[model samples]
Target: MSPCCNWMWGLSRRLVLSGRCQLSARHNVDVHRSFSSVPHPPRVCVVGSGPAGFYTAQHLLKHHTEVLVDIYEKLPVPFGLVRFGVAPDHPEVKNVINTFTQTAQSERCGFFGNVTIGNDVTVEELQAAYHAVVLSYGAEDKRELGIPGEDLPGVYAARDFVGWYNGLPYNRHLNPDLSSDTAIILGQGNVALDVARILLSPIELLKKTDITQCALDALIQSHVRRVLLIGRRGPLQVAFTIKELREMLHLPGTRPRLDPNDYQGLGDITKDLPRPRKRLTELLVKSALEEPTEKDATRWSVAEREWSLRFFRSPIEILPSKDGNKAAGVRLSVTRIEGTGDNSIAVPTGQVEDVSGGLVLSSIGYKSIPISQAVPFLPKQGVIPNSMGRVKESPGLYCSGWVKRGPVGVITTTMSDGFETAQAILEDMKSGNLNCSESRPGAAAIQKLLSLKQIQPISFSDWEKIDAVETARGLEIGKPREKILDPQEMLSVVSN
Candidate 1:
C-alpha cells in the first residue's frame, strides 16, 4: 500500500484498539481495558460521625455507585451531637440516628470511631490515603461570656452542662451544685430554654429520659425552684423557637413569671412579624397578659417552681458570693435596641440590674476550634475558609457542618450543608478538578497506621455492642438508655 494509505490504516487501528471502536470479539474486553483510561473509585474520608458527616456520606453513597466513604470519629461511639449534645428529653430529635445507622451499615461505607483526626492521623495523612477528606468535626467549644466571675464555682458553660447531663465522657463528672433555689441562664436561645426546663421539670419527668445517672442524682437533690433566662435583646429579638417556648410554658410543675411590661405592646405588633416570630411573640404576649386556662391556673397556683424571661439585659459580670468563690448572681446592664431584626444591636442604657441566683449557666453559643494548623481557619468566624464546602486554597480538602459555617441552625440545616459539600465533591470528581487517577488505600492504609500507633479504631459492630450494653443497663432502670460515659468503658465493652 502507498504511504498515505498505510498511515490512515494505522490511525484507525489505533482508535479501534483504544476502545473507541467497539468490536464483537471475545478478546475485546481485555484489549479495551489494557488501553482504556478509567480512574480508580474515589475514596472519601469524613472526619466526624455527627449528622453532617453521616449525611455527607449518605449523599455520596446514594449518588455515586463506586465511591467509598469512611467516617472517623474521635469518640468510641457514633452520632456526635445526637449522642452527646441533644437534650435527653428530646429523644425524637435523635431519631436521625436510624438513618445514620443505615449509612454506616452500607457496604461501601465504613465507620472508624475512637480515631481523633488531628491526633491519630493528620489531615495531610488523610488526604494522602483518600481521594478527598471532609472536615465535619463540628464546633466543640462554647462561646465565652467574657465577663467577670465567669470562672466562679457555680458558673458553667451551657454546652458543658448539656454534655454533663447527656453522658459526654468529658463532662460526665460535672456535678453542678444544685443547692440554690434560683439558677440564672445567660442567653435566650433554645439551649437556654432547655436548661431552664431541665432545671424546673419534676424529677419524675426526667427519670424516664436518658439523662446521665450522675446528672439525675444531682437533679434529685436540686433545690432549684426558679430559672431566669436573660437575653441581650428585646422579646421580639429572642433567638429561641416557638416549640421550645411552648414546652417551657406547659412544663408540668413550673409556671411562667414573664414581666407584663415586656409584653405590653407585643400583641399589637405580633401580627406584622414573620410567622414563626409572630407565633412566638403572640404566645409570649398571651402568657403575660391573658389569664391561664382553668387547669393551668390551678396547676400554677400550687406550683412551687417558676421560670421567667428577662430581655434587654446583657450580663456584665457574674456576682460572687460572700466568699468570692461561687457565683451568687449576675450583674446585667440594661440595654435598648438600636436597629431592627438581626441587625438590631443592644446598646447600653446606662442602667444596671443585679439579679440574684446561686447557679449561672451561659448558653450564648458554640464555636469551632481549628483542629490543625494545616487547615485554613478564620478564628474570628470560627470556621474553615471554604467556598460551598470546598476548602479555600486546599485541593482535595472540604468542610461541612458548623466547622464550615459557624455553629447555628438545627439538624436539617446541617443536612443541607452536608449535601452541598457532597455535591461539591461530586462536581469536582466529574469536572476532573479532583485528581483521581491514582488508587487510594482508604481505610486499609489508615488502619495500619492506627495499629502502629496502638490506636484501635472501633468498628460499627463494636459500637453496637456498646449500645446493646447501654440499652440493657437502661432497661434495668426505667430510663431509655444509660449511656456509657467513659471512652475506656465503651472500648472495654467492645473488647469483651
Candidate 2:
C-alpha cells in the first residue's frame, strides 16, 4: 500500500477504537463524552471526471481538512465533455481545464482513468469501499427525434456529429456524408448554432482548431451551401444565448436569412423581457431589420453559402428520396406559441410544410442513462432522484450535474451544482450521518480489485504523457493539439 493509504488506514483504526470507547462509557455512566480527537477523514469516490466531478472534489477538499477524494473516469483522458463535447473553435470555454488540473493535482485527490464503475466495479462496491460515493457521470445519451425516416442514411443526431468532429473516440468512425447541398438542423440551441457555423465557416478557420483531421478533410470537400436551423417556437422562445447567435451573425462568407415578418411583434415586447432575453431579442431584431451595406451586398452577391433560422416549425418526419434510402427533405408541422416569454408552449397548427434538404441533424437535447441497478433513476426525466444533490433514500450516495438535475445549463451552472453536492457531503459528515470512524481502504482496495481483474487504470501522469504527445503531433500540423480518436491509440500513447 502507498504511504497515504497506510496513514488513512491507521488513523481510521484509531478513530474506530476511540468511538467504541466513548459509546461504552456513555452507556455505563449515562453521560456523553465528546471524542476530542479529530474523526477519521471521509474517503469519497466520485464517478466521472467531468466538470461536475472535478468541481465537487474541489469543494470537498476546500471545505474538509483531511478528506480524500478519488475520481474515476471511463475514458483514459479526463475533462469529460469539455474535452469531447465543446466545439473546437470555442477554445476559451476549455480554459476550465486549468482549474480541473489543479484539483487533480491536490495531495488528497486521486484520479483513476479508464475505470468504468458499472462494468469494472459496481456502485455497491464503491460505496462499500468509501464513506461517500458521488455519481456525476453526466448525460451521455441523446434524446431521439422519434419521427418517421429518422433512420435514413443522411439523417444524423447533432450529438454524434459534434462528437465526431470533437474527436470522441466512439464517434471517430461516424464519417457523415456531407455531399448534400442543403442541411437542416431541427433545434435552436447553441449546439444547433455550432453545427451551422461548422458547416458554413471557412475551411481555413476549422483547420487551426483541434477538430479531428478526418472531419476537417471532409469539410474541405463539403458541398453544403445552405443550412436551415428549425425551431419549434418563435424567435422570442429561442433557447440559444446571445453569444452563439452573435457569432453566427458575424460568420464570414455566410449570409443570415431571417424573414423580416418574424420580427413584426417582437419589437414591442423587448423591454418587458428579462435583461438576457431582451438583449438577445434586440440583436435578432437588428439583424432582421438591418439593410445590407454596399460591402454586404457585394459579399452576398458572391457568397457561396448561407444559413437561416426558421421559427415555429417542428419536424414531423424526414422524407426520403425516391430511392427511399437517403434523406431528401423534412416534413414540418407549423406551430404557434400559446403564452409569451419563457412559459410559451408550442402548439401545432395542423398545417404542414415540406423543406427540401439532403441532410438532416436533430439537436434537441441529451438524456441521462442509469449507470447501475443500485442507483434509483427517474426514467421519464432521465435523471437520478436526488434531494439537493443527496440521493433520495440512499445513504452514502450522492449525485451532481445533469444526473442530479436535468441535462440543461452551462458550465457555471454545473459548477454551482457540484458545489451544492459537496456541501451536502460536508453537512452529512458533521452530523455523523456519514460514519468515517470505520476504516475503508478507499482507492487502495479499488486498485487491488482492478489488478485482480487485469484492468490497468490510467493515472493523471499517464494522461499528461498522452497530452504531451498529442500537442507535439499537433505542432507539426500547425493546429491545436490533435486528439487521439481511439481508446487503444490513447492507451498506447500513455504506455509509450
Candidate 3:
C-alpha cells in the first residue's frame, strides 16, 4: 500500500485487529465498562516493524503495562532487514530475529503487518487513531554514484545485489550475472565486503545456508572469481569494522588481497594504518615472502589476483565493447590529490582514468524515501523532516529507525533512536499533547480507502501464516525459513 517500490521485503502491511469492542443495541446505554479511577492509558502507534520498532515496543511493554501500542509495518513480515537484510552465513546476526519475534508477540502491543500511512493510511488518519506515532521504516532506495551508465543492466547497487544473494523477498527478480569473469565493487564498507564474500563463495558453501532457492541457483552458475573493490578515497576511509575485515581475511578459500598502492600517498604509512590494516598488511607481507609458485596453505584452491583499491579515481563512463550489449569495462577519471588528503572529504578534482572489468557494482550507500504524501522531506538528507524523532510539522507523528536517521548506522543505533523517540512520546503524553478531542478518523476509514481500490495492505495474521509456512520451509532446507518472494505467492502462502 506504500508508494515505495518493492526492494528487499517490499515496504507495506494491513491490520484489521479489534481489541476494544462492544455490541450496541437500542437501549444498551450502560456503555461505561470500567472504574473511572483507572488511568486512561495513552496509546502509541509504532510506524515500523524493524528492530527499532520492535525494541521500542518491547521496552515500552516491559515498563508500561497500561499503554496500548500498535505497530504498523508496510511489509508482511515483521523483522524488516533482520529477516531480509542479514547474510545467510552469519546466522549469529540472524539470532536477533528470535528476540524480535518474542517482542512482536505481545499482549499490549498489536502488530499491523501490511499497512502504509501517507498512502493506504495517512498522517491525518494516524493522528486520529493513536495518541503518538513513531516512524521507523528504514531507508528504501540505493544511494547513487551519480555517474553515467549506472542504469545499465549489468550495473547493480550493492544494496540490491546484497539483498538478492541474501534471499531477501523483495529482490527475487534480481539475478545478477555473476557470470562475469571480473567484478568491480565501488565501495569499502562492510556491505561491500559482504557482497564480495558472497559473490566469491562456492555455491556448495552456500547450499546449507538460508539462501533463497533462486539465489542458490544463480550462485551455482556464477563465473566470477576476481573482484576488484574500488574506493575513490584512501584505505583509511573504508567503513568496514575490523571484525568483518578480519573475517573476510579468514574465509578459508577466500584469499583477501591487499593492494599496496593504497598506501603510496598516505605519508608515514606505518602510522596511518589502523590496527586492522596493519594486521592485514602484515599477513600480505608474510605471504609475499613465500615462493610465488607455492600454493596456499589449504587445499580449498583460492585463485590469486592482483586486485587493489585505487584512490583519487572517479568513474567517468561505462564502456561496453561489441561483446554486443554487455559491458566491457568502466572508464574512470583520475584526480590528483593536492593536500592533506588523509581524513579529508574534500577531494581535489582535475585528473582522469579508465579500468576494464566484466561487471560493476555501485556500493555508494542506501537512501530512506518518505512515503507517498508524507511530505516535508529533507531532499539532501533523504529523511522525513523531524526533530529528534518528533515529527513536528504533523501533530501525533514521529519517526525512528533508518527513516528517522539516514541509512548509515547499525541496528543498535536504530534501537537507541527508537527508545529516545518513545521517551519523547511519553513526555509529550505527560504534557497532555495527546488530545483526541476532535477525532480525525478511525481505522474503518483506512479500510474504506482499501475498498475503493487505493492499494492492498497485508494483515498481522497474514504475516503469521506466512511465518508458519516459511519456518516449515526453512526446516525443510536445514536453514532459516524465507518468506515467499512474489506478492501473489506470499498472499497464497496464507490462503492455501
lDDT string for model 1 (343-366, tens) is 899999999999999999999999
lDDT (Cα, tens digit) per residue for candidate 3, span 156-274: 88888877876565677887877677888887777887788887776667777877888878777877777887766655556666666666656655675555554544445545566
Candidate 2, 178: how far from true, in Å? 0.1
**After superposition, candidate 3 runs with Cα above 4 Å error:** 1-39, 264-308, 336-343, 346-349, 372-374, 436-461
Q: Estimate each model's TM-score.
A: 0.92, 0.91, 0.83
Deviation in angstroms for 461 in model 2?
0.2
lDDT of each: 0.86, 0.86, 0.66
Clashing pairs in 2: none
Residue-wise lDDT of candidate 2 within 118-178, one digit each (tens)?
A: 8778999899889999999999888999999999999999999999999987788888989
Higher-lDDT candidate among 2 and 3?
Answer: 2
